[model samples]
Target: MNADAVPGLVAVLAVTVTTIAIGTWGLRFSRTTSDFFVASRTVNPRLNASAIGGEYLSAASFLGVAGLLLVGGAEMLWYPVGWTAGYLVLLVLVAAPLRRSGAYTLPDFAEARLGSTVVRSACSLLVVGVGWLYLLPQFQGAGLTLESAIGAPRWVGPLIVGVVVLVNVMSGGMRSITFVQAFQYWLKLTALLVPAMVLLVVWLDDGRPGSPSGSDGAWSVPVAGEGAIGLYTTYSLIIALFLGTMGLPHVVVRFYTNPDGRAARRTTLVVLGLLGLFYVWPPVFAALGRVYGRELVAEGHADVLVLELPRLMMSGLGGELLTGLVTAGAFAAFLSTASGLAIAVSGVITQDVTSRFVGERGPTASVAAAFRLAAVIAVSVPVLVALLSTNIGVARSVALAFAVAASTFCPLLMLGIWWRRLTDAGALAGLAAGGLGAGGAAVLNLVGVEGSGWGAALLAQPAAWSMPLAFATMVLVSLATPSRAPSHARRFLVRLHTPEVLEQAG
Candidate 1:
């Protein structure tokens, strides 16, 4: 590696070490198995909101959003807009009732609401699938960040991040996960915010240079692929991101840390503000990249634009310092979200998979041991997949994961929380439809499937149709199988709809 890259190397090392040190501090409070899974339900609103912002931003927000905008034009703004709006949808419809359900994971909610072990098991598998899907991009982005900043081999990035994440998770569980993520949120905001401000100043200093390649209108417009397919891709991406936020496994598990429904809603409200603030900067980077870093787009290395634009537009110590800062934020992006997904996936696996085989008596010992084992499995599989796969445009790959989540869990959560007529059989059928449709499309996408006309558009962006299909299948099956509704459905709905103080008054 070049000597000039030393600052980048230091920044990456410093972030990782600081993360571990903070996790060690949080580990002190994580004594029991319950503490490990949900931070013993003591996380406050601001802290939880910061943690959510940390985990929710992922590679897509850090690097992919800017890259997509630079390459695909203004149409790409939909990605960030839908992502933030999804929280509004969650806050209005799902947040409070979900917290009130008093479930540690989605499967816990499934079993509680429907009173069926069958639905719980299915939901468990879907949670693991979605977590792994989301995790792949983080690991891939880590490799990209490390390579871009300091010239480390791509594999080293994923390996180092995987190890660090495993240590954090196995050591402190949700307590450490929460602290690390909250810290990362601010780190990422500063990393992007400072550079964006400087870049804006630098752009003004340059007397507002013209587009590097000319035809600035193309890059500023809201169209990507034109015609019918283009329209489908844009709408499907919106559906996936807007509804998908409520369905992501890592995002949903955060609610379980809130002490009450009110706190859950408050956390979500704060999260929306934090996310809205952070998202405003990516487009700035994208627009600046159009002027200063156009070659990255031409070279098909757009993911590095955020890391490269600093050095491209400036010089000497100042540029190197900004590069290091973004590199640190990028690494934090991988570490925070990867760690959050680790806890989310492992929790489900421990509850449904590993815990089933844990032979020790009592809740504490068995749950802890099982969780440790599940954490290993949860982190390992995605690391392997990320290493074996080629770059699929980090943002695009994440969108596929969102498509699957939107199709499957969006329906289940919306219906399960709001519709008393929902049955386990209905949920099971809908999950199957959504999983098969979106999962099959995702698999095809990974294997390089495409063709002319509508097939390609539908396969490329399945959420628009798949989400509605899942909802319809769930509703129709639920209508036909009204007899299969949980016996306590009314009481459960009352509990969800009622405030905690009201339950006490009753």
Candidate 2:
């Protein structure tokens, strides 16, 4: 069977066009800034759950995880489990309080909680930086998936995604994005599931049961002499993913979009279920690919397992049709996740910078114009990086971003919301220490330093030490700078702790 991508590309574009139409239509409902930012805080838990799932399942989940599992054997399963369970940690620690804080962005919470414009500005910059870093893989993966499945040039996927994301974001903010993400979630799941079922049956019919004919070590086996290092990586990664959810600007922002704290918690639980279900399929792809996709490994095309499965398992027109379906699904993955990230980052730009233009220039188009400009800046850096770089692993890059999030903002948020002793100085010191620790390590990795064992331990799991350093720095600094603390510390604590139903706005 041969794969021809023309039909698949057409199908993907058609769906993308329909998605745009739906989002544009939703613009009528976005009447205020609050609506644009948090969907006016009215998104129901179920719909919000699907949207969260859609946004969370990026190219990493759709392509990288299965590819890693195919290449790394059993060790890669940790990525999905850790990712899904991160929400559980979010549920227990930050979800309700974050929602009740009435903050639109992370910076909003920082200013309201810590009473420091400097801190708010720092937080906002970090939000944009982290958001863009996360966005790169979505763009890169989109390009790779499209080229492999449809035979287009590398830039086509990212260009398509960038355009779609900009349109969705500019047409309607959170209100429209909420509906679009929910729809994309189901579209993505069906895209993968239907093709997977078909491919599995075809492989079974050919009697290629376990390891793709003659490839010996492709089963659920540990890497030779690397078990201990792998275990350390697994535990540390779990720690990062578990605690990191509270700090991710996009994820945290989503909770605030829910109507109430209870609804926020309920939304998280639903996300856990949806993410859990989505994760089950990736390993299946890896395992099945082991049985029928050894050729991909030999060809160094492991990432194309989901895309190439149809061609390998079937022949003739049936193969082409299945390839088209999988291509559409893969494109859906890129478009949905990229759109979500763009919206989050662009919102920060609009709120922080564009509002100033409105007050200064007296221009009627300031708000919308600023947001569009911000969207360009937010997506451009990541897209350029994606085009320039070639060595970073997909899962590793995403995890590093998670480590940065966990180490820096996690401490500030946990301490700010729950600890009354948290002061501006403390938060600042912690951010510096953790940002240096995690960010430095990530930079080293970016420069292509390969270290295993203790060296690997430092680079692979900096959060284990960096997170503690941030927490200790915050505490000790708070003690030393007690007088610099927010004057309304007690009042802020009361507000953050108050039930949404019982609270009165001050």
The digit string of per-residue lDDT tens for model 1 on 302-338 reads 9899999999989998899999999999999999999
In terms of TM-score, how similar is model 2 to the real structure? 0.93
Local accuracy by lDDT, each model: 0.90, 0.80
Position 499, candidate 1: lDDT: 84
Best by lDDT: 1
State the lDDT at 303 in candidate 1.
87
RMSD (Å) per prediction: 1.8, 2.9
Give the alpha carbon lDDT tens digit for every residue of 1-506 in model 2.
Answer: 22376767776787789779879988889777677788999999999999988888888888888888887776566678778888998898889988888888898899999999888888887788778768888888888887887677788777788888888888788888888889888887887788777777787778754753222453333332257665566667777787877787778878988999999999999999999888877777787888778788888888878888777778788887877877777777777777777878888888888666654433425666677777887777888888777737666778888888888889998899889989988888898898889888887887788875678777867887888899999999999998998899899888778886675453
- TM-score per candidate, chains pooled: 0.97, 0.93
Worst 10 residues of 1 by lDDT: 212-221
- The alpha-carbon lDDT assigned to residue 426 of candidate 1 equals 92
Assess candidate 1 and give its lDDT: 0.90
Give the lDDT of residue 348 in candidate 2.
86
